[model samples]
Target: MSTGTLYLIPNTLGDGDEAALAYVLPAPVRERAGTLASYIGENAKTTRAFLKRVGTTRPIQEIEIHELNVNTPAGEIDKLLKPLLGGIDTGLVSEAGVPAVADPGALLVRRAHERGIKVVPLVGPSSILLALMASGLNGQSFAFHGYLPVDANERIKKLRELEQTSRKAKQTQIFIETPYRNKSMLDTLLSTCAPSTLVCVAADLTLPTETILSRAVSDWKKKPTPDLHKRPAIFLLLAH
Candidate 1:
């Protein structure tokens, strides 16, 4: 019997707006997603909603969705791949964006590789890649740090370290913050980095309120900061 394939599925970055979903995801991806009956997701509710949007032929209630999140123990991750070992292809979906890239699904993918199961990643919108593409920063050499520290002092220290790294290596540093803490993160960035450094803040990507702006730290200070509170955003810093 052949081992099953592990499909790394991607979901919309923003709220489930049909137009945005249609524009970002291709028909082939949606069609394939709809055919799968077994899945592992970070959040079950969002996973069902996404499956429905993709036109899944299987009844939402009937689909097998195993939850994988930060709370999931490393030892139990291997059990999640049992369906694949039994020759049943399994789909892995995250709360949003691509699975396993800065997402909890990475653990499952790593285990799949160890078990010699086929791992396939489908095409989808990644906020990290989209922000890099539009930021006009050093995309050729960049790093995504996921999220910065929430503590004020620790966050400032991390910002300085990233700034130094960006300047020394000419590599763009990409990171994110919780939606509600977006404004506070922006304040730290403005105060911690040098005035000449460039900061790109891409907020509400793929949504009607989408905004991607890259400007010097000094310039950002001169203008009124955009209200980013309660908004999903990606931040990139480059010092050339």
Candidate 2:
């Protein structure tokens, strides 16, 4: 029997407003996802909630939602893919944003390729790209460096290096922080980067509360700090 295709599903940026679902994902993508019987998600509970919004054709309870997160063993990849090998179409759902871009599901995607299973990426919201789009920075060249070091000193050192790289290469450097650490990340960015470097803090993308702030480091210090506390945000910087 032919192996099933692994549908790379994109989850919303945030659950700010349920009414906004209609516009976040295209109708065709949602319709197709609704028909899937199996899914491999970063978090099964959230995946079920997302499918609930899509109004799955079959009862959500009947659908198989398996978890594949940061803690999932690499050796277990093939096991999770057994259903797909049996010709069961499965969706690789991310906790947020597109699957595989900055998500752990990339491993599953690669294994699927080795097994000759088709991989399909559906259109969806990606906070990283969306932030860069509105940041008024160098869109022609950019790089996303997932997360900086958790230690303050290390993160600060990393930020300085990224800014210098952006200055010399004219490339946008992008990264994200846990919701609770958003404010801390912003603080590090403001203090560590050069005064003229362009910094963008895009929060709540695609949600009703979406906010994109892009300005020089000096200018950032002049205005009241945004309430980035506990808010999911994507940070971008470009140096001249």
Candidate 3:
């Protein structure tokens, strides 16, 4: 009987460097990548370098490709996964942060599970968790609504709805936008949310020059952070 495996990688911790990265990823994942590299005619060094902060490794029989919206048919996921379904090792990685946390790795995971493949989530830094940690808001209850609406008017309407929901639920509301749209998103947030509501902006998280600032919307309205171009960020709303 063969066995399959999935390795969940984490985002960078404080910064994207070897020393800071060492503590954020699972040690076992690093070890496992070494082992897999040996079988696949690849160097563990390169593989390790590619996955410096994703996950610790483990033994498995197969590894499926980890991308999204491929032309492959849904039924074919089973066939392609035959090698790993019984007992293969796989890894899920997002561009930044853990897979499925505003990224597109969930489809592959769901398909894998339908076939009885064992899924292992490796411990690592999560941007959402990091944002919540620094938000200075009610962490006990919160909702991550993924990316906000792209259209301006729709986006503001959604933000208003989210604010109302947050107030009633007494939970923090978290959302994000593509890097280029950060400025627009911030503007809409400022215009839409109440003046007294507490807002947290976490930019370039885990990267050099990371900033986690929490203050009233009115304060930010005066002197806003520079346009968040060229940086990844998450925003949180905590009603007082």
Candidate 4:
């Protein structure tokens, strides 16, 4: 039997903003997701919600869903691939953005490649790419550091290092912070990065409340970080 293909699905950035679904996701992606009978996702509950929006072809109860998160052991990923190995086409999705990028499931994708299972990625909104596009940064040579150190001092040091690297490499350094810590992250970034360093804060991407601001650290310090509290955001840095 031909090994089944694994589809990498993209989830919306907003929290249950179903209205934005048609705006960010293509019809082909939703159509393909609705046809899949199996899925692997970081959070089953959210994945179910996503499928519901996609209007799955089969009854939701009949579709099979498996979990793959940061907590999933490396040894267990192969077990999750059993269905695909047996010719069951499956979808891989994350809580937000595309699967296997910032989220878990890269291992599953790698394993699929080794086992000869085809891997396909569907098009959708990715906060990282959206932010970079709007930031006017050096997208050609950029690196995405999922999340910086959480510790205050450590995060500051990391920001300095990223800035220096950006200057030397001419590469855009991108990172994200937890919603609740957005203000603190911005504060440290403005304080730690050089005055001329270009900083971008893309918040609430793809939603009606979306905000994307790119400016120099000196200009950013002229005013407050703009109500970033409890909002999903991506930050980009390009040192001069």
Between the candidate structures 1 and 3, which one is better when assessed by lDDT? 1
Answer with 1 or 3, whichever has the higher TM-score.
1
TM-score of each: 0.97, 0.97, 0.82, 0.97
Sequence-dependent TM-score of model 2: 0.97
Off by over 4 Å in 1: none
- Model 4, 82-118: lDDT tens per residue? 9999999999998988888888889999999999999
TM-score, prediction 3: 0.82
lDDT of 4 at 121: 87
Total backbone collisions for each predicted model: 0, 0, 16, 0
Question: Which ten residues in a row are the worst by lDDT in model 1?
Answer: 14-23
Candidate 1 TM-score, true structure as reference = 0.97
**TM-score comparison, 3 vs 4, better candidate:** 4
Which ten contiguous residues of candidate 4 have the minimum total lDDT? 14-23
